[model samples]
Target: MACLSLDLCVGVLLLIGLRCQSCAGSKVYSSPGASVALPCGTRVHGPCSKISWKYKEKFFFFRDLVESGKVIDMKMGRLRVGADCSLHISDVSFMDGGQYMCYDGATSANTTLQLLNNGADEVFAVVGESVTLLCSDSTSPGVGESLRWSWQKKELITANQGGDVTVSANGKKTEFKINPDSSLAIKAVTAAHSGYYECSLFNDSGLISIRRRILLHTLHETTDLPSAPQQDVNFTLTCSLTCAAACDEDINLTWSHSSGEQQQGGAVVKINNTLISQLLVPKSQASQTSTCVVLREGAEIANHKWPVQGGKEVMYSTCSVCYPRFLTS
Candidate 1:
């Protein structure tokens, strides 16, 4: 039993030694101005051994910094190595993004030093116009793996230019056709369509990176409608607010007839953000009503009245008169 216990202890030590030998510490820096550090460490089995650091394929520093405390060459001048073999480089540049190596004579380790540019390409398109979203890395397009484009309505995914969609991401060249040109071609442009759209790229290493965002805006024309019903012939009154996109919610439409009759309906039945209110009076109940009120969003925006029979053909007009004192009171 004692021999078995001794063997178990040896096995545990071996496992720990393997992990320590393979462990590599890594740190990242940003491009256009940042710095990073790479730690070189061992299990401390014996006395501390020599340490070395390398950037890309060139050696930047050695154990000399621990004893001499002096800068080396141009790139190495910016680096500092501690007694424990940790490397530090200040004022990092775009070219500094790449592979880094750290060595402790007992065991050597390598780490990736990625200097993210983080500057995304700007993509813009006018409403009803076609636009292409591009993704780029330090390397040019058609040189890497594949690029992807995706659109979302708030948190929900609306369109995908890759996978099921017909987006092609060959090498670094990724392209997607916006059939109708606009994201909201089939659906009208509404406030809901105004959100963040992301374009990304996937490399051979299976890393997904975002490229840019596409901003969408829709322009629309505005009009005023009546707020109160006119005391005219019993006719249906309709009010509509049209835009490039569908409304997020049903429009609230209210109808007010001078005869103390109030009717309400939603815009859902109109297939658009439009309201229709009918105040029917059989030919027997026909009366000389003067006006009809159309209330939208709880505000009397417009009013319409039956045309006074003056000539052979009736002419309609919009009256800008104020609401009666009795109604306000």
Candidate 2:
């Protein structure tokens, strides 16, 4: 009986040493909406007939306890047990941050998952409004991970030519301007700013700490819309537009007058930050419908028709003041 007890004690000590040497202090970091793998301890050998992944006592991932390579129940579809008995989680979230226990029938291995919260999908800002793209580091602040900011903008019109913007810790930009904060900010947004932007945080060693893709959209403002012009006095049909945040001046405005009226001086003017255009026509011709078009890079952003009747509704009158005088004579 004494010899049997000694053998049992030796077996327990060996198991403890194996677990410690294999994966006692495994730690990994994963960004939000990403995937991560937790390796089982080196002590785990032999065909993995059964595997389980657990948080605390709750089992979230289970493989064939009775058979090999068969999944019994997986609480989330994002979970998969690798052939090496590792736990691979897809689309990881902050809620997934915790200690994960991996059981390989005889013994278990544990790993710590740290989830970073720097993931932004889309951002919408009115033209001329300021916007900031967010990025954060989840690790403890004092852990001394030197972080730097890098921004890249994707061009929609061209597939080959691309631009990049980088902001250092001191708030200096390489090509474009950005806020000193870890977030990238655009003061005045324009249609040119509309594109896919990638923001990545990297350590001084050039390793990526966190990465996120942002789709930035800028809104255009079409205001002070024209109403139907009256048929009497000399009328001025006007269209006004607000300036884009990016201060893009590659914008054009034009007025299309009814064909019945001889064309007059129709001019576009910039008043302060607003683009205004006026079309002056004689009272007799003003009643006819006209069109106001605002275009940016050949794309019409604002199109309006005055006096809904449109140019097609114009009716030309053959008789004028001179004709009446002639008839009397």
Which candidate number would show the highest lDDT if scored against the true structure? 2
Clashing pairs in 2: 128-245, 188-245, 188-246, 189-245, 189-246
Each candidate: RMSD: 19.7, 18.7
Please identify model 2 stretches exceeding 4 Å from their true place. Answer: 1-119, 137-144, 148-180, 204-213, 223-329
lDDT of 2 by residue, 91-143 (tens): 78887777665655566666778875545454444444455665453443224
Whole-model alpha-carbon lDDT for candidate 2:
0.49
Worst 10 residues of 1 by lDDT: 320-329
Error of 1 at 235 (Å): 23
Best-fitting candidate, measured by TM-score? Answer: 2
lDDT of 1 at 71: 35
For residues 168-192, write the lDDT of model 1, one tens digit per residue.
2223322234332222221223333
